[model samples]
Target: MLATALSASIAGVDGVPVRVEVDVAFGLPGLTIVGLAGSAVLEARERVRAAVRNSEFAVPDRRITVNLAPADLPKEGTGHDLAIGIAILVASGQLDGERLPGTALIGELALDGGLRPVPGILALVAAARAAGARSIIVPAGNAPEAAATNGVAVHAADSLRAVVRHLAGVEPLVEVGPPGPLRGEHQARLDAPDLASVVGQRVARRVLEIAVAGRHNLAMSGPPGVGKTLLARAVAGLLPRLEDDEADEVRRIHSVAGLGARPIGSMQRPFRAPHHTISTQALVGGGPRVRPGEASLAHRGALLLDETLQFRTDALDALRGPLDSGCVTIARVDGVRAIPARFMLVAAYNPCPCGWAGVDGHVCGCEDGARRRYQARLSGPMRDRLDLHVPLAPVVSGLRGRRESSAEVARRIGVAWELQRRRQGGANSALGADALDARLGFEPRLLALLERRGRQLGLSLRRLHRAARVARTIADLEGSSEVSRDHLDEALLHRPKDAAA
Candidate 1:
């Protein structure tokens, strides 16, 4: 007898439908799974056999062959365990095969027949819905995420016995309702470290506001404890909350990573600060099996590199491609997969090896050559990519005066973001050169100022364009229709003079 069931496999963050075909024939008792199953998946035979026997079902003494269809595609994970078991039950004449069509099963099975939650339930349901599956069965723990998909019927089953009973019509499972939108009435609250907390770096805060409004990359150089890391964290809090569509995209990425609860729709943006010891592959996403790296994980969020000079030059350079394209593509022996990496890059570093280049109290201790080498760790090309560069000064007691809260700064940022969205249909940072020129009609005087500064600063063509874009964002924050001379001057101040040298 032959029976087929529906299942799903994950590739990157998307889902692929897999048909689990089982054939049971009279022969010596044995079982085998084919079709590019990974080691974990190939080991599911013992799990399925033990689960079936423990679920009060008979394990037929015959040759059992399980084949995951679309043999060309590699199947990873044990999500196919339940589907394989059900197919076997039907092939062995213990259950009706007629009820299996148009239904997808996704779950791992324990030896005692309990269903285990699997990752990427949201993507799995999406694939099933696209494939025209009438219904999907998932573990009870995963029902909420599965039901989050619209226009798809989801059934939550607790164990193999419950699933078998539902299939046999002894007691049909209840259809799960749509998951309620994330709870918490104050979900819009953004509790970021306020700019006022830093006391004296008024200029740095203003530049940060521009960066947040425009989604531009920023870098900060100062001695330790000068509020660079704090400023980066505050930027995360100041970013506009994820919209409904953006929230869904973030949830899908987290789901594929097997992370916990789906993110609540909060205006609080993500802040990812990976340690300097991270490998190049870990930053760019690569291995025997390609998985999402820090860049992808920071999608629609912020990627903060603290002690930026300490990171490997290769690892830091890996960000160049994704920074320009807003996505990372990993090509492996398996295939090519693209992952979204649209994120704001913020990096912090010290000015010298001793981190005391020109402080009031601290004297410079590092030699000129050592200082040059320390700065050389970040190549010119990489430095050019940073849109805003602000040198932070140490926080003094007098400078730590009362200032605005995160809520207040967030309100201003939100207002500026809405203006950009309405005028440009996206953040100012993502605007193309032509679109920027058309929308941000720069005054000839301001254009000449940029040209003169570009020549004097020795800015590359790319840097010149980026400077213009930054100036455009500054104008947007000021509620101006065109880039002005004042805006261009302010934008220039944010660029590191030493970097230009």
Candidate 2:
């Protein structure tokens, strides 16, 4: 006898449907699982057998052959344990259904028959729903996460016996609906660093708001004690909540990374600030298993690199592809995988090795060689990718008047985001050269000015395009329909020829 159950396998943050086929026959008592099963999947044979026996279910004393079709697809993780166990019971005549349709199973099994939550439950559920599964059974611990996906019925089971009882119609599992309000008690914006805390650096604050508005990459260079850290962190507060599709993309990525519901509260965008010591692989995502790295983890959100000068050259340069293509592409022996990495980059660095080269009161201690070495980690090409640059100075007095709160800046940012979405369907940074030339709402006069400035400044096409995007964002912030000359001039000021553009 043979039985089949639907399951899914995760691949580079996406999910692929897999069929769990179990065949029981009269032969020497043994269990086998084929079809490119990873070590974790292969280990499920012992787990499923133990879980079934411990659940007080009879295990047929026959050869059990389990195949996760299609045979060419590589399956990893222990998510298929429950499906394999249930299929075996059905194949051996211990259960009624031989073929389960419109239903999918996803869970790791414990030796005592209890179902355990598996990573990527959201991705798995979404995949099952897309594959036409009307309902999906996951571990109780994963119920809330799976239910967040919506559009599909989620049935959570605590143990193998519970699933068996439901399948047998002895007891049906209660359906879990979508969890209301992905946001937590306080909104994410309220919890992030408030812009009012930093007493000075108005220009840096303005640039940060523009960066958040257009999702442009920004770099702040100053001595250690300046408001660089505070200004950089304010991006989280200014950032708009993830749009529906954006949230879905973010959830799927984090879930695939096994982050669970952590760092996803209030349905806020991710803010990943990896340490400077992180390696190239850890920064860009690469290893034997090829999991998503920090860049991908910050998908549709922000990736902040504090002390950017101390980071490894390889790590800093590795971001060039993602900064250009909006995705991190890793080519392994198996195949090439492009992980989503559309993120706003917020980086803060010192002026020199001693962290005080240009400050008014502090004198530089490091040699010119050391300063050059410190700055060289961020290569010329890499530096060109940053859309806005701010050179901060130390605070001078008690307060520079009254600084606006993050909420106030966020209101303007919200308006700018709506303007861009309605006008261009995305942020200004996502615009292409063609879009910059024709699509962006730049004043007719500013177009020729931008081209002339590009020539005088020796700006590349990439830099010209970046300047146009920043100008458009500035215009959006001011509620101006057209990118005025002042907006372009300020945008060009942020992208100096000596630095970025």
Candidate 3:
């Protein structure tokens, strides 16, 4: 006899429908799985056999052949265990195959017959719905994740026996209802230490707001304890909450990375602060399993590299393409996959090895060559990508004054962000050269000033475009219709000083 069941597997944060085909025929007692099964899928043979027997179902001692359809697609993971087992039971005449069509079975099976929740259940359910599945069977632990997706009937089964009973019409599993919007404790914000926590550095605070409001990359250099790190953390809350579409995109990436629960509930943007010792593959997403790295994990959010000078030069350089293109395409011998990496880069670093290259009172202990090499670690290309480069000074002693809070800055940022999205349909940093021209519409005097400055600074076309966008963002914050001289002047102040030097 033969039977076919619908199943699904994950592929680059999405799901692919898999047709689990099983055939039981006369021959020596053996089992084999074909259709380009990865090691995880092949190993499912023993797991399914044991789970069937342990669940009090008969395991036919005949030649059993299982094939995952779409032979060209590489099938990995243990999600197919339950589907293959159920297909065998139906093919062996123990269970009816009538209910198998238009229903996706997704889960791992333990030796004792319990169904194990698998990662990417949400993506699997979404794929099932896209494939016109009428219902889906998932592990009970994953019910909440599955329920979060719309337009799918999800049945949570605890064990293989329970699934069998449901399929045999003996009893029906309870259906999970649609999950409501994330609220309260479920929506944990990233540790955005309040902007007001930093006692001073008013210029740095304003620069941080502009960067966050426009989704621009920013870099800060200062001696130790000058509030660079604290200010970096404060930028988190300055960002508005993710929109519904953006939240869904971020949730999909986290789900594939096996980052559970928090992303689904929070709707807050991702904030990834990878250690400086991270490898190139780990930073940009590559390993045996091709999981999402820090960059992709920070999709639709911020990626903070505290102590930017401490990171490996190669790893820092690896971010250039994604910084410009808003996505990373990691090509390995196995296959090439592109992952979304549209994130604001917030980086902080010390001025020198001794932490006082140019501080007035503190004398630098490191030699000039050491200082040069330390600064050289961040290449010109990497430096150029950061739109705002603010050099901080240590706070003056005995001057106590209150600064604006994150809530206050966030309100202004929210308004500015809404203006940008409404006017240009994206953040200022995302505007291309033509888009910048169309949006800025500066007068001849402002245009002449930019052109003359571009020549004096020897700014690359890319940097010129960035300056125009930044100026436009400044105008938006001031509620101006066109880019003004004051806006251009303020934007110029934030550029890397070396651009003029």
lDDT (tens digit, per residue) of candidate 2 on 143-168:
98898876788999999999988988
User: Please, what are the lDDT tens digits per residue for candidate 1 over residues 1-501?
Assistant: 999999999888899999999999989899999999998899999999999999999998999999998998999888999999999999999998777888999999999999999988888888877887988999998987777788878999999989999988899999999856653322232445666676667777888888888899999889988888888878766777777787777778778778634544532455688999999988878676566788988888889999999999999999998999988888878888988888999999999889999899999999999988889888877887889898888876545447776667777778778887787678878877666454466766767778899999877877777888888888777778878778888888787554425
- Indicate which candidate wins on TM-score: 3
Using TM-score as the measure, name the better of candidate 1 and candidate 3.
Answer: 3
Displacement of the residue 288 alpha carbon in candidate 2, Å: 2.9
RMSD of 2: 2.3
Any idea what lDDT model 3 has? Answer: 0.85
Could you tell me which residue pairs clash in candidate 2? 183-266
Candidate 1, after superposition: displacement of residue 228 in Å?
A: 1.1
Q: Candidate 3 lDDT, tens digit per residue, 118-222?
A: 888777888888888989999998887788787878999999999988988899999998766764422224477987678878899889988988999999999
- The top-ranked prediction according to lDDT is 2
Q: Whole-model Cα lDDT per candidate?
A: 0.84, 0.86, 0.85
The per-candidate count of clashes, in order, stands at 1, 1, 0
